[model samples]
Target chain A: MATELIKTRKLAVGYGPRGKVLQGIDFTIERGDFLGVMGPNGSGKTTLLKTLLGLLKPLSGTIETHAGGGGRPLFGYVPQRESLDTHYPLTALEVALMGRFGRIGMLRGPKKADYQLAHACLKQTGMDARANKPYRALSGGQKQRVLIARALASEPEILLLDEPTNGMDVSSEKAIMELLSELQKEKQTTVVFVTHLLHTIERYAHRVALITSDGSLIVGEKSKMLAPDVMARAYKEK
Target chain B: MIELIQVPFMRHILLAGVFVAAGLAPLSVYVVLRRIVFVGAAVAEVASAAVALAVLFQLAPFPIALALTVTSFLALSRLADSQRLPLESLIGMLYAGGAAASVLLITKAPRGEANILNILFGNILTVPATLLWAMAGVFGALLVFQYVAAKELLISAYDPDMGRTLGIPVRAWNMIFYGAMGVAVAIAIRAVGALLTFTMLVAPGASALCLTGRLNRAFLVALALGVVSAVGGVMLSYQFDLPTGSTIVGLLVVLFAISYGIGQLRSAA
Candidate 1:
């Protein structure tokens, strides 16, 4: 009884005319699904995530998203930590409050309930103690947690994260994965993430999509996708 | 200082300086935080060029300057996502082109050399009453816009991709932000000159961010620094018979240096 949230049919995505990275991609993301996108470097993993987020236009084909209320599905995106500039003097709480910006609408400020939600998200990510701390002063792991808090503060139906545990120690990575796991179970939130770490997919993802260097995609349940021969065939194309 | 303030013309100059500082200071916070300081210089230069063109054509300076600066800012906004060239490179091109155009166009006009000097160094002492009123009106409107849209502007500038995912219409917001900044720069050039306008956009924000290290407090600190530098620079200039625009820029640079040193010490401790 999986509820399909997003479906892509023969979708082609890339930068432009000369930058066709992936083609003939088909996938469906369902509610409460933990989906992992995996590939080698420059294999269109991030591009696919960007395409799903509507940050980039598809080169060809169509993406259809069905939300319960009949409007565009709300998304909470956690970009790579390095993509953000640390020069801003925003506190963690302030950064998290950005999630409420759209809901707060134009020409309006955050209200008391918005602040309460942001604080609650920060606490969920174990960052409540440092809510007032400068984001730049945080360590890599703490910064990642704050970013997760920011995403969660949006209260999105689908959470899309790009390399959430990138550049973290093993323990930090495990802790982040565990936190995400707990959130998925507790909230029944749909999760889609891009990762180069196979173990991350093998452990947490219900389904996995592998993008090869030849611009082909292989997607299936994690049990079949994580098989040694299947993984070897995908990596061999690189 | 009291004696200087008692004079009608001196009071007008002080009022003009305060208006320009108040308008540009809060914007300076965004300019510094977003690291688009060169964009400010480019806009100011383009506005100056427009002024030169208007003078050559016997047209009103402010309208033409506002139109051209706003147009140029909108054009430059397209480069934000360009992969072929960095935005800074394009902005640098605009800066150089504007500077050259101003010089070349001014040379063909009557009293062109004097006009060029005025645009560069500003003739703040002789600012007309009409221009003062315009500055007050425009800057007041800009202040209100900034206050109302502060949260949206901050989120859009800080993480545009995330903003996009949140359905923020980041590009449109950016265009509006740049457009407002263009209006401020255009008015500021008329009040203080191109060079001082650029300095006001960068220095106060940089100094305040360094000192406060908090976004909420940074705007107030930046405004205070801007007003202090403007008033201090004017007084020092009158006392020393120095150039007013240059004096203001110098004071801001000094303030920035002091703030940077203090910020370093605070971080170390």
Candidate 2:
């Protein structure tokens, strides 16, 4: 088993009145481990993922991401495709290269090595040949793959995904999930994935954190968390 | 009529229009894309308020208006950056405040056809030499935005989140763009007047958007359309005995319609 790579203490998630969707949520994942967070909509599962990724701030408590050492954490992120305006003029390759922007800094453009790295990421994600394609022209599956390649370009020590399989047809979803799984198995990068797909939560997640309405995190093993009674309570349907 | 270019006033009118179109057209694209329409109008109202003050105090209207535009931008910059309100809401508030100030200025000024009518509706035919210089200054500001701030501007215009995620400094970019746009408007408002400023700001850019498929292409087409509209509008206005700014705007509307039609057909095909 991989050693602990992330730690959070009593973190709350969400914004405005909806803020604190997930409350007092404490969690951790080891390097090379896959942890899934599952909850009903508005339960703050997605918000918690955003918090961990530094996309959103916790209302209370602290979450420190281990980028490994003093260096900024190099990690991949797969944002929901719908959140992006695919109609933007950038090509898939251009969009993917945006992953390097943090390191590329201002004034200076990306280097050849950066492009090579992006290409390699694309190759790994099976998107190399489609690099020239306009981002909008790509189908939903292709966009997800391109996004995954972009995340990988950062060569992050950890990968954070927000509903990666959503808005995708079953075949596309299956393909993308398989690709991610294959990547994790080979790369040994820590994976923190959020999803509502119960089958995925059951099948692929090594550990699971169940979030209740009002942003409460219930953490445990996947099988333990996936119990119907636990889910019923988490969803508050019982 | 052709020999009138030798006259300084007519020269100022046509030249100021050139400068206004140059800056306003592309700016409108950014405005439309950013979904912040009437930002130019708001800024112009503030400038007009400053002009009214200068007139009341017997100060030079252009210089005073320019100063007020800058002042509003500095204040608005702070307001725009603060998190209490969304940028759009803040700009709207600024708009209302500026209009109130200008209206107060006009109310307090010596009410005359020359003071209110000329300043409010714009004295395009009587535009003076100084307006040309103001146009040059604003055009320089626009160049800075196009080159010095292009990348940041593009990012901020399209996806502010991604811009922030990439650490492009969205706050600074916002301030700079808003400030530059304000400066550009202050320069042109005297020539185009408050009522018709959006015509110059929005028309050429909107027309170009209709004309082109890509961002760069859109901007280039916008520049060309702006120049043509400004020059053509004045001449056509004279030819048809119409208002100068209106004629220009009408021509721009026609171009936009034509381009839209063509783009639609092309898309259909």
Candidate 3:
């Protein structure tokens, strides 16, 4: 087993005074652990992912991670694509370069190395040819690639991607899954991916955490965790 | 016939027009993008109250006007962040409250009715010497700061979360931006007065956007447009003896209409 990278203890996740959507959830992820958060809609899977990334603070629990080098760990986060408004006056290269911000910090401009990283990430994501294009004009699949490049540019130890295959074609999905698998093998990077694809969960992820509507969390291998009875029971509570 | 543009005060108005072109174009662009033109109206109402208080205490209107504009702007922004109250409601309250206060203050003025109408619409070409110096200093600083921060500002305006993730303190940047806008409005009030000043702030910028459609290039176009309108407006005002700010803004409206027509023609093509 690799060293523990993210450890959350009894983390209860929800918005304020709204009551908890997820309660008494505990887990620790190690390097090389591909964890998939699986649940039905409004089952707190997304909220759990958000809680892990510190997007939303847990009402009652502790989430301790060794991110950043003495700063909050810079995780390459692929947020929900639907949440962003892509109609601004930015090019693909400029948007990709934003990922270097955690490394660069405020006030100071992007440096040579930052551009190099952005360029490299774009190449890796097959978005280099469209670097100068307006971001809003890109297709949904291309937009997803740009976002993935942004995450890669951050040089994060862990990648937290939300629905990485939402708008992707089958070939693109295969390409992405292969790339991610290769990245995990080469760098031992831990990925906490949130998706609803049962095949993807069975094929790519090493472990799965199933979140239920009543705030129950189940964590184990795919065979044990993805049984129809287990999934039905997991999603049955509302 | 006297050459008004040749005179220092007329030159100051031209120069101040040039200064406003730097920030107002992008400010207008963002306003249209963020769907927050109502914020501009809110600031204007708050500034009106400050204008009233300035007249009542016999205080110089510039400093007090600027302070009130920034304070109220910051308060509104914070209130927006907290979602404490709906923004439209707050703007309404500010408008009604300020109008009420100013009316009360204007009623108590020792002299006969201060021509509040003049303040509603500015007379730009008649700027005083001290006000000229203040415009030069403030406008110069904004120009340099904006040039350096332009890239970051453009990014933040579109995707604030992306900027935050990238380590741009977008909240702090926003405060600086709106505060600077308030300062610009205050500087404008010295000559054009409060109500009419939005013309200088909004018109040149809007026209530039309609014509060019690119952010950096739009600044140059807006600056040129502002100067042409001011210089041309002053000439017309001198010829007809009309209100200077009205003439300038009127010219701006004409230019905007023409530009909008041309833009539609181009886009349709």
TM-score of each: 0.97, 0.85, 0.86
Return the top candidate by lDDT. 1
Give per-residue CA lDDT, model 3, range A1-238, as digits (tens): 2277788888888877476798888888776778888877677777788777765778998987765465456678887677676535466887788788767745567899999899899898889998888776787777777888888898887888888876677877777777777778887777888887777788888889988657778888888888887788676755
CAPRI-style class, candidate 2:
acceptable
Highest DockQ: give the candidate number.
1
Candidate 3 residue runs with Cα over 4 Å from true position: A68-71, A167-182, A196-204, B83-93, B104-116, B203-224, B235-242, B258-269
Choose the strongest candidate by TM-score.
1
Query: What overall lDDT goes with each candidate model?
Result: 0.88, 0.74, 0.72
How high is the TM-score of chain A in each model? 0.97, 0.93, 0.91
Q: Which pairs in model 2 have colliding backbones?
A: A21-A214, A21-A215, A22-A215, A23-A215, A67-A73, A74-A156, A75-A156
Candidate 3: residue pairs that collide: A67-A73, A68-A73, B122-B192
lDDT of 1 at B143: 83
Root-mean-square deviation of every model: 1.5, 3.7, 3.4
